[model samples]
Target chain A: MRATEMTPNDKTNDSTEQKIFDAAHELFVQKGLDGAKMQEIADRAGINKALLHYYYRTKDKLYEMVAKSIIHQGIPIIQKTIESDLPLEEKIIKFVDFYIDLIRRNPFIPLFIISEMNKHPEQFIEKILPARLPRPEIFLKQVEDAVAAGTIRPVNPQHLLLNIISLCVFPFVARPIMQMVLGMQKTEADQFLKQRKTEVTEFIFAALRPR
Target chain B: MRATEMTPNDKTNDSTEQKIFDAAHELFVQKGLDGAKMQEIADRAGINKALLHYYYRTKDKLYEMVAKSIIHQGIPIIQKTIESDLPLEEKIIKFVDFYIDLIRRNPFIPLFIISEMNKHPEQFIEKILPARLPRPEIFLKQVEDAVAAGTIRPVNPQHLLLNIISLCVFPFVARPIMQMVLGMQKTEADQFLKQRKTEVTEFIFAALRPR
Candidate 1:
C-alpha cells in the first residue's frame, strides 16, 4: 500500500468530502456493498453517521459515485488516446502505457470494477460504457484506416478493442490469482505490469501485422 | 440451452457423479459461496443435506468439487490445444471454437471461477491451478514455430494467452452489462456469442499475421 501524497489544498468543504470518499472507498473495496456498513464508513471517515448520510444520502448513491470516480481513472485517458489522431501502433502503445500507469496509481480499481460489475452489471454499465464512454469511434475509424492502408490484416473494430482491453486488464483483474501463478510480490507485480506496457503493444502489433 | 447427449453404456458412474455435480452446481452458481447453504444443495439434489456432506464433507470441499467439475468444461481442452502439434492457425481456431461452445454450455463457469477465486484466491488457485494451467512454454513454442514457419508474427505467449482468456471470458463476466448495453435478452446474447465465435478466430489470426 503506497501512501498517497496528502496535500492540504483542502477547503473546509473539499476536506470533508474527501474524507468521506476516502473512508467509503476503503470500506467498499474491502467489504463490498452487502458487507460494508454505513456506520463503519462514518467511523473510518472520523465523522458522524449523520454527516455521512447528509453528504452521500444513501449507500447506493455513495457506491454510484465511487464506481463512476473509479471508472474515470482509466476510461477518460483511454478515450482520449483512442480519439487521438496517432497511428495505429502508437495508439496501442499509448493505451497500454496509460493503463499500466493507472493500475499502478490505484491497484484496486480493476477488481473493484469487475466485482461490482458482477453484482449489478446492468446498472453499472448503463451508467458508463466503453462504447458510449468517450471516443471509441475514433479507435474504430483508426482500425478501419489501418486495414485499408494494409498496415494490418483485416479485423473487426470490436475484436481490436477487446484484444487491447483484455491484454491490459486481465493481469490486474486476476491479480490475486496472478500473484500466485507468477510468484510475484506486490512490488514485483507493479514492475511486471510496467514492463508489460511495452510487451503488450509489441505483441499486439506482431499479431496484427500483415502476413 | 442445448440438450446433453448420452449413451446408456456411457452413463454408468458418470451420470451418477454428474447428477450430484449438476445439482450441486446449480446451487453454487445461483447462490455463491457464502450465500449457498448445504441444505439447499441437498434439497435441490432431492436428498438430505447429510447425504450431501457424505459426498463432499465441508462447504469449501463442496465448492472445490463443483469448481473442478466446472473447469473441466473447457480448460483441459485448451491446455491440450496449446500443447498440440497442430499449426498455430488451426490451434487458434480450435481454441476459439472450444471456448465459445464451452461458455455457451456453461455460462456461469467464468463468473463462478472469478468470484470464488476472488474470495480465496490462494486456496482456489492452489487447489485448482495445474502445475501449469495452460503453460506459457507450450504456447510460446507454438508461437516460435509459427514465427519460424512464417505463419505468424512474433508474440509473447503469456500476453497472448491472457488476451485469449479475456476475450472468451469478459463477455460472460460482463453479461449483465452487455445485455443492457446492446439492449439484448438471453437469446440475443447467445446469438451474439455465437457470431463472435466464428469471427473472433479470424480477427485474432488477422491481427497475428505479419505486416
Candidate 2:
C-alpha cells in the first residue's frame, strides 16, 4: 500500500516501440544477454525483425535500453523517497514498502541487471547510470540524521541502506529458493509476501531503534 | 568462520569425472542449461567429448548431477544448523554466520539454483530433494520453542527463516548491484561483507529480541 505514490512505467502495456522494448526486456531478463536473441525478441513481440531493428538496431542497444528503462522506473522512486521531507522512520518504512512492491511486480529485474552488470560492468556504468543513477547521498544523509537524533543505534549508513535494500528485495529476487525453503505454493507465497509489508517495516524499525 | 563445521563436497577438486562435473557446473551456472554446450564443457575441462560422455551421458543427466551436488553440499548444512540444540539466539547467529560464509565463497550458486529451479522446478524436486532434502521441522520446532519460552517475538518461523536467509545471502548474490548502490570497489565490498558477519548478526538479534 505504501507504493501507491510511485508507479513504474510498464512498457509492455503501451506503444509499438514499447511493445518491442517490453518483449526485449522479458527475453533478456529471462534468458540473459548472451542467451537472448534479437530474432526471438522480435518474434515474441509479434513484429518483423526489420521493425525490431528499426526500434533497436542491435541486441546490445536493446539490452541497454531495457536496463536504462528498468533503472529509470525503479531507482528514481528510491532516490525521491529518501530525498523527501519525511522523518527517518517514516522514510525507511516507505522505502521498504515501495521496493517490495516494485520487486514483486518485476521479480527478474534485479537478477537480470546484476548478472548483466557483472558481465559488462563498464558498459552498464557508461550506459545505465548516466540515464538515471541512484543518489546514495540522499539515503546516506537520512541514515546519518536518524543516527544523530539517537533515534537509531550507530551503524554505517551504507551498510544500513544495503540491509534495508536486501531485506526488501531479496525475497522477490530469490523466489524459487524462498518457495522451496518456505514450502509454499505460489498463492501461499503471494500471501506471505503481503504479510511482509508490515513485518519487514517492523523488523527494520526494531533493529534501528536506539538501545 | 562458522561454516568451517560444514564443508561442501567439491566434486570439482577430486577426479576426472569431477573435472567434467565442475566444468559443466561452471558453464551451466554461468550460461544456463540452454546456453551451455557439451563440447564446450569438454574443452573447459581439457577432456575429450567421448570421455565427457563416458562420465555423463547427456546434458540433462549432467545438469541433474550438478544440481544434486550443489543441493547436497548446501542444504544439509542448513538442516543441521536448525536441528542443532544451541540456544535460539546463538543458533540463529551461527546459521547467519555459516550462510554468509557459504554464499561469500560461492556467490553465483544462489542465483544459479534459483534461476534453474524456476525453469525446471519439478526436475529439481525429484532429483535434488530425494538426494538430500532440508527438514523444515527442526527449524520450525526451534522457532516455536523460542516463542513459547518468550526468548523472541512470536513471528512465523518460515518468515523468520526467509528474513535471515535474505539478509545474509542477498548482498553476495546481487553483488554487482550492491557494489554500484553502495559505491564500493570490489575490495571494499569484500571488506564490507567481512563486517556483515557481526553487523547482520546484531541486526537480526536486535529485531528478534523480545520487547
Candidate 3:
C-alpha cells in the first residue's frame, strides 16, 4: 500500500502536525487569541513545547494559519452557492440549509469569528479574509430583480439579505442564553436549530410575498 | 443646592468611584475577564494601582459588579416592555425599537454578554443574571394567541420570538463583517441601524400576516 511504502518517520511527522493543528484550533476557539497560550496548546496536543515551536514558530503565526484555514474553508463554498444559477428562492433555501449545517458541525466558529472581528477589525478584514470575498452582488441583484418583477415585495435588498443571514446565524451565537431562557436541554437545542431550516425559509418567503 | 452643601471630600470620592467603574467597564468590554488587568484599568482610570485596589479589592469582584450592572440595567426595561398589555404588533414594534436603540447606545454589551456566557455559562446564569429574569412567557403566549385567533399565520411562538430577537441583535453582533461585506462607512452603518427599527417591524408583521 502507498501508506506502507512511506517511512515510519513520515507518518509520525504527519500525525504530530495534525495533533498540533487540532489543539491550536480548539484552544483558539475556546479562548480568544490573547487568552490562548502556546504552552497550553502544546500540552493539549500531547507534545513538548520545542516540537510545537519547531512546526509553528510563534503563537501569532499559528493563530493566523488557523484563522486563514477557517475562512478559506467557508468562503469558496458560500461564493459558489450564492453565485449559482438557481432561482433566488432556491438559492436562499440552499444557503440557509448549508450555512446552518456548517455552523452546527463547527459550533464554535460563529462566536470565534465575531469575537476576533470585534477585537481586531482591520486584521480580520485585511489579513484573514481572501482578496476576493464571497461576492454578494449577485445575491443582491437577484433580490432586486425579484422585487422589480413583482415576484417579491419591494424591500431593501441589503436589509433583506441581513435579515436572512441574521435569522440563520444568531441562534447559534446566542445559544447559551437561548438554552437558558427557553429551558432547553442539549437535545432540544439541537432540535430547535434543525427546525430553523424550515422555519426561517418559510418566514423569509412569507415576508416577501406581494402585498 | 444639595450638591453645594456636600463636603468636598464626599464629592471627590463619588467622582473617583465613577471613574474606576467607567474605566473597568471599557476594559472589560474590549478584553474578556481573563485578558483585562487591574493595572491597565487603573492606568486608564487615571488612578494608581493602590487606589484601584482600594476601590475594588480584586479583578473578579470588579468584573462581577460590571456584569451585574449591565444585566440589571437591561432586564427591567425589557421585562416592562414585553409584559405590557399592548397588542402583539405594537408590542413587537416597541420591543424592536427599544432593543435596537439600547444596543446602539451600548454597542459592546451584546458581544460582552455573549462572550462571557460562552466562557462561563454557570457564572453568568447563576450569579450575574438576576434571580428573576426578563420573562418571555407573556410574549410567547401573546404570539400563540395571535396565531390561534387567525390574526397571524401558523407559527411556533418560540421560533417567532427567536426570529424577532435575531433580527434585532445579530446586526450589532456581526457589525464588523457586515460593514466590510457591504462596504459601509461608519455613517452608513449608523443609517442602516437606524433604518432597521422600521424595517424589522414591518418585516415581522408582513411575515405574520394571515395567509
Candidate 4:
C-alpha cells in the first residue's frame, strides 16, 4: 500500500518494519551478508522469528532493503551538495566537512558497502544503485571551469574527486588498522578524525592552488 | 620442525602444507573467515578434509596463519621503502607507486584485511601484527625535518602519512563502486589506476609545497 493510504494499523506495521530494518542494518554492517544470521536479527529487533519472517521473508530481502535505504538516504544529500552553486574551493570545503561528519556518524558504512560490493558487485552496482545514480558531471564541469579560469591548477577531475573521497572515507574504513598503527585509543582516534575536516580542506585547496 | 632439521619426508609434508596455505589464503580473501568453509578450502587444496585438518587443526589456526603470512610478507617491504634515504618527494612517489601496484596485483587484500580487522580488531591488532610493527617514525621525522627546514609547508606528519596511504589504498578497496560511479569498464578501471601513481604523487607534492 502507498504511504498516503496507510491506516493507523498500517502505521503500527510501519514502526515494526522500521525496527526490523534497524536491526538488520546493524547486523549486516557488523557481520556482512553471509555472516549475519536472520535469527540473530530477529532477536536483536525484539521480535520473534516468525514475525521477522512475516515482515521480511528472507535475509536477502532484508539486506536489499537495508542497502537500498542507505543509498537512498545518502544520494540526495550528495547530489544537493555537489550540484550546489558554490565556488569550487568552497564546494570542496563543504563536501569534505559534510562527508567526514557523515562517515563519522556511520563508521561501518564505508567498509560494509565496499566489502559487500567486492563480494557481489553485479548485485550492488546493477540492483542496489538506482538507475539515476548521483551524477558527477556538474561537479566535473565545475572543476574544468575552475582550471580554465585559472582558479585552480589543471588536474583530472575524476582523480580529484577520488582523492577528496579517499581522504575522507579511508580513515574510517581502515579505522581498526589506523588505530593500531597510530597507537591511538578510541578517544584519540576521534580527535584525529575531528582534525581531518580542516586538514583535508586545506590540503585539497593547497594542492589546487595555482603556482 | 625447523627447515634445517627436517627429514626427507618432511619436504613432502612441507609442500602439502604450502598447498593448504595457498588454498586457504584464496578462500579467506574471497569469502572471509566466517563465509569461507573448511571443506571448500580442503577441496581447493586438492586434499581431503582429514588431511587439511592434519595440517592445521582448525579454521582459526589456518586463518591466523594466512593473516600472519600477509603481514610478514608486506611489513618488510614497507619498512625498507620508508626507511630508505631518499628525499621526501622521491620517497612519496616511490611509496605511492609501490603501494598502488601492490594493491592492484592483490586487489582483494585491502578489503579483506580491513574487513577482517574490523570484525575482530583485538585479535588482529594484538595477535596478527608482529611485536615489531613497521614503524613510521623515520618517515614522520623526515616530514618534520623538511617542514622545519622550509622544504615543505607546515603540516601534521601523521595526517600527511594517512593521506598518502589513503590515496594509494582506497581506490583498490572501493574499486567496484568507483568503476560504477566513474562509468568505467574493468580495462578502463585498470588504466585509471595506472595513472594514479603519477596523479597521486603530484597531488601530494603540490599539497606539501611551501607557499
Which candidate leads the pack in lDDT? 3
Chain A TM-score of each candidate structure, as shown:
0.82, 0.85, 0.91, 0.91
Q: Residue-pair clashes per candidate, as listed?
A: 8, 0, 0, 0
Of the pair 1 and 3, which is ahead by TM-score?
3
lDDT, candidate 4, A64-137, per-residue tens = 87898887877777778888888877788888888888888888888888898888778787778788876788
Candidate 1 lDDT over residue span B132-180, tens digit each: 6655466667877777777766665655666666677677666665555
The C-alpha lDDT values of all candidates are: 0.70, 0.78, 0.87, 0.85
The candidate 1 chain B region of ten consecutive residues with least summed lDDT is: B1-10
What's the fnat for candidate 1, on a 0 to 1 scale? Answer: 0.39
By DockQ, the better pick of 2 and 4 is: 4
lDDT of 2 at A100: 83
In candidate 2, position B155 carries an lDDT of 76
Which segments of model 1 are wrong by more than 4 Å?
A1-20, A35-58, A84-90, A122-132, A145-151, A179-189, B1-24, B34-65, B85-89, B126-136, B145-152, B175-189
Ranking by TM-score: 3, 4, 2, 1
- Give TM-score, chain B, model 1: 0.81
Question: Candidate 2 — number of clashing residue pairs?
Answer: 0
Q: Candidate 3 on B1-211: residue-level lDDT in tens?
A: 2222245455364487778888899999888787788899999999898877676777877888889988898878788998888888889989998998999889889999998889877877877998887778888999889889999999999999999999999999999888888889999998998899899999998999888
Predicted complex 1: CAPRI docking category: acceptable
In candidate 3, list every pair of residues with a backbone clash: none
Better of 1 and 2 by DockQ: 2
